[model samples]
Target: MMTSSIVQRVSECFIKPLHPIEDSKQISYLTGWDIAMSSMHYIQKGLLFKKPTTSPNNQQDFIESLLKKLKYSLSHALFHFYPLSGRLVTHKTQHPPSYTIFVDCSNNNPGARFIYATADVTISDILSPVDVPPIVESFFDLNKAINHDGHTMPLLSIQVTELVDGVFIGCSLNHCIGDGTSFWNFFNIWSEIFQSQSCENENDVPISRLPFHYRWFLQGYGPPISLPFKHHEEFISRYESPNFRDRFFHFTPESIVKLKAKANKEFNTTKISSFQALSAHVWRCVTRARGLTNDQKTSCKLAINNRLRLEPPLPQEYFGNTVDVVSAEMTVDELLQNNLGWAAWKVNVAVVNHDDKQVRKMLKEWLESPVVYQLGRHFDPQSITVSSSPRFNMYGNEFGMGKAMAVLSGYANKFDGNVSSYQGYEHGSIDLALTLTPNAMRALELDEQFVNIVV
Candidate 1:
């Protein structure tokens, strides 16, 4: 076993402060995705290798050698950023960008078992999956499997099944680190590094001198983005509750297209996208399912990427939190009666137009504002909330074996949290995964339309 001191020393080598920029506004923008950025500093993608039955005794040596290789490779990555951090900080005071791989041979399944490892991949590649397992026969009870500790990196368990000589690996990762795309890219790069190593005994890890420049995002930008007080208050209120449910709902691609087509035809609107239509439909379905009246209030929060919304696109390699949560709230009556087109229009109005300088300014001021600016006094936590991060077309992720079979998002460990995602299937169908409170799903189960295909 590795000593704690050894782990601590390795971690320190990776955590270093950057050269302070002249402008805080730019710093904020650069760090807008700072939470995500900070989390990246603590990234750990573990690969579990199955030890051969005959070679079980060599596992310890393998681990030691592997650790040396990983430490060197990751330490090299940290070194490239040293100049940017003024080299004042050494690895001792900082977090390192290394992950761990454990070799488990304790299981008694001698020849029946296999091997597997997990790593990062590109942002685009991680989100989209080319294959998906058959829908579980009874998904209602699947809730027991989802767990979210809300730690910087939440661990998810995957059910492993045997495939060929090696056992297929089951995996789950926290979304806060990077979207599906970023996750895959990191994995692919790691795989490239791993596959080329002849043995874990290499004295030096190779360094990838990729670009790390980010000054372009702040060329002519000034600061102090102000966001609507009502919007800020609304989010705070909804999220304030100590308890929340995050449920996952799955829908086929054909169902989504059909829903969108119907919305388009019914509303006589051309600009509304599938997301707006589906979100609107879900909002309507759940509202009516819960028996909420038309006059009651509900809202939907869409997580928008701010990378390209600025005057110029943020760097593709810019590793940070570049997401903005945009909310669309309306009286239940308006949401229910409005044609699909109009409902979608509401989302576009709140999210797409985020490029406006005023909006950016307001957002800055709001985020920077202290807790005293919160508007929680006006609302309750029980109000309805919805969010979606689709994974159908995320860029460039491919494990050496092939594309992932499926991807799911917003899984929660609690009883009241609801999270949603749009998954792509090999059959050309889109799947919807909604995570909601058991009661909420139970309510949904009563609907014949929803019940027939829930699993």
Candidate 2:
């Protein structure tokens, strides 16, 4: 657990107007999509630090110093310093969507933060493990601590666990503020500041002065662009009641290599990669495991950053949401009948030239639809939030400790099979974290063909 003094001190350094975006600005033609893409909220990556020797006695003080330096470093990173214009839809009482941070000082490790908390901060965990699997132990503990409901932090938590080796630092952030690429950009800067290799200055923050035009976009685009209600109950439920879920899975390197090799052969395209194949394959696995038939239609919403694809790629420092979703739809039959390669092919079709006019219009309509408009506002962190995009993996996000072994959303807030894939894992295969209903998981296992292959 961390101390209030340290939290307070760090808060004092970071909680101020580190970056501000005026509500009146209008985003440029392509940039408007950037803000819209970023509007989709998710959790930032989970970070693990080797327990420092000085931590045992003055644990809290050490944490405070680290946080103060972290905040100062973030203030210098271009991504953290940009402005936001996605706040037009927020309720008056809600805090503006710049960078909001929350903290949890609980006695027990909760393991995940997207759901409601059932415990409190009376004392630290007595049953804490002495030898945790270095990264995994700190990862789970931090989730348990920071995801607690009463507290919300812009920078998730700087958790101190009772490890045999030493104290480990766990840091998290909310994705609504920045993507993994942007987060790493800030982290690299933060590391330099920590080492005193770079000096902090107000000008170090990026200029997020891009024009924002929600009103104009809504006015210029009509009908589907204005979220429509197909049914009152489903439409209203998004606001009346919201649901979210998340879950994680572990895979050895061998499993991923087999899947990738199979995908490559099946697709008849050596260029077809694991992310494309596995994401499609898993979507098929889970959707099928959930008993969705081929006749039914489902959409695979993938995030595509418009930063470089736009007429003029957004300024490297232009930090508001600059992503858009490229979705692919298939009948359950088509998905069920196809091999991983077929699925990969379909995914390739959906993602290639993803920003094409028809595809963009379709995506715009879905986001503007009444169900999404209402539900997105009341989205529950505990409910499943799916982000299968590999942009985070493609972006160079190494801090001093080295690139993250795996990264999950700090804001996903649920255990319902919210899935993510990361680069540089144990070996040839990819590693993924997924949240799935217990029943669905069991069903997959009970089905001999699917179960025997992966396990």
Candidate 2 on 1-455: residue-level lDDT in tens?
32221111112222222344333332222223322322233343544333345545675565555545554454443233322112122111223312211111111212222211112121123123221122332232234322112123332333323234322233454343455455544444445544543333444433323222222233355321322223223322211112322334444566656767888898787766666666776777776777865577665555565556554345544443455556666777877787888877777777776654544565456454422222235322222234544434322333333433334344333334455665434444444555556567666557654554453
Can you write out model 1's per-residue Cα lDDT over 1-455, one digit (the tens) per residue?
11111101111122221122233211212222322222121111222222233364564454445444443433333233222211111011113321111111111111111112322222223223322211221111112221112121122222222221222223333332233344434444434454445444444445342424332223233222222233222222222323323334566666767767877777676767777777766655665566667778777666566657776566545433455557778887887677666676777577767784744674455345422212233222223334334542421223233344444332122213233454454444444554444466567658765555333
Number of clashes in model 2? 50
RMSD of each: 12.4, 9.7
lDDT comparing candidate 2 with the true structure: 0.42
Candidate 1 global TM-score: 0.55
Task: Please give the CA lDDT of all the candidate structures.
Answer: 0.39, 0.42
